[model samples]
Target: MPTLEDRLRNCTRSAVHLEMRDEYMPSDPRFTAWRNGARNDPADSDPERRPWLRLVADLVAQGVEVRRARIVSEPVSDYIRFEHHLTVPTVRAGEQVRWLPRRRASGLALPGNDFWLFDGTSVVFHHFAGDGELAPDDEEFTDDPVVVKLCSDAFESVWRQAVPHADYTLA
Candidate 1:
């Protein structure tokens, strides 16, 4: 028989026993997929990702005095009108707001298989293994998945490359 490591390295279609979940809660034990998105990628997009809507509603609901920044740009440039609802607040909702300045900022680095996002909650870092290997169970995963580790390292490198936020004048 092949070594256990070899068997686990190619977990292309295996399932692990785990707690019942939302069936799409991400972090599912048996899910074997990866992509370039936030650390928290729901099977369907979540409204919580729309920080702009939450901000506006929160401002009106809580009536917290809001000084705003109104510049939002996505280097990917893939967000649509519905997504823009959140993009606006993400662009404008903080005492200290900063957007990822990839295509615009001077000295921006090359795109890698990693991304970092801060939503005034905590810094979330995402690293994807572009080598296209499926992630095995934490209990069963083997191969050290060095490509994924490298992706995580690349995320740290880019986080260091981030520029400080500048206030928007909202012209």
Candidate 2:
């Protein structure tokens, strides 16, 4: 099986990520800083500080349309708030992002987990623990059309109702 990085590197057309977790690893340094009242300067001059930015920019240069959607509970978690504020760099790197309040997500038949769909042909499902930390070595990738289509459909549904990051505000 190809690594996620390999899949991403080889992806053509579109790459979409759907994040459905309220909290990820609280121990991550960035999250820790946010918890300590630090703010993210989306306009920070240094863009290459993060490698993902380079990868995203490269993909965009290749005409790959990258997008991400998040489903979060209202009265949002602190981590979600942090992530919301940090999306600017992502947009600057040539990706579109949206946010969907979980309340608005009811009745949708979403997948059991969050996933990244590449070129609408492959999926990488993220598995997490009960406390919301990612499980070790838990990324499951598949090329099965049925699963891919289900994820594609679910993502589109959420994307349609989701608010663009620039317009989204925590309530």
Candidate 3:
């Protein structure tokens, strides 16, 4: 039997991750219901997904590169993981990963497929292919720079529209 570490290595090295927006629901038949809501907002994180993070951590230990991008409501907390997820591996075995956190200042935009992420290099969507297999509401990217640029422009537009999470925090 392969040890947990070995299994993780295999997964990390050969995993076609399905990027899901924060509103992706794996068990809902309705078109409106997503994976989970505010309390279950894994857009930034969750307990169930921690294993994947651990896997990435392991891969980093073995000189594997991981690129992760998330549309987080509060980018501050998620930024904490960028180092552990990307940098450590680079040092361990010359592995490098990019953890890009696109802060989504909540309440401004609905928690659905309102937006996608295009950080100049990648066009990450929500949910690659699985239980809820479907194209993004905004199907523009089709081997055209215009499509990706549109996504990036949309990101910046949303970014400018969104308010700082700390703006509404209780002191």
- Which candidate has the highest TM-score of all? 2
Predict model 2's lDDT versus the native.
0.88
Top-scoring candidate (lDDT): 2
User: Could you give the candidate ranking by TM-score, starting with the highest?
Assistant: 2, 3, 1
Error of 1 at 15 (Å): 22
State how far residue 110 of model 2 sits from its true place (Å): 0.3
Q: How accurate is candidate 1 locally (lDDT)?
A: 0.31
lDDT per residue as tens, model 1, 1-171:
343223322233221111111122234332333323333344223437644445434443443332221123443232312233233444343322223333343443233322222212111222323332323421222223453344334334434543324432221
TM-scores for every candidate against the unseen true structure: 0.25, 0.94, 0.31
Q: Candidate 2 residues 45-162, lDDT tens each?
A: 2466766777889899999999999999999999898887777887888989999999999988899999999999889999988887779977998989999999999999999999
Global lDDT of each model? 0.31, 0.88, 0.37
Candidate 3 yields a Cα-based lDDT of 0.37
Number of colliding residue pairs in model 3: 10
Better of 2 and 3 by TM-score: 2
Query: Model 1 Cα displacement at 137 (Å)?
Result: 18
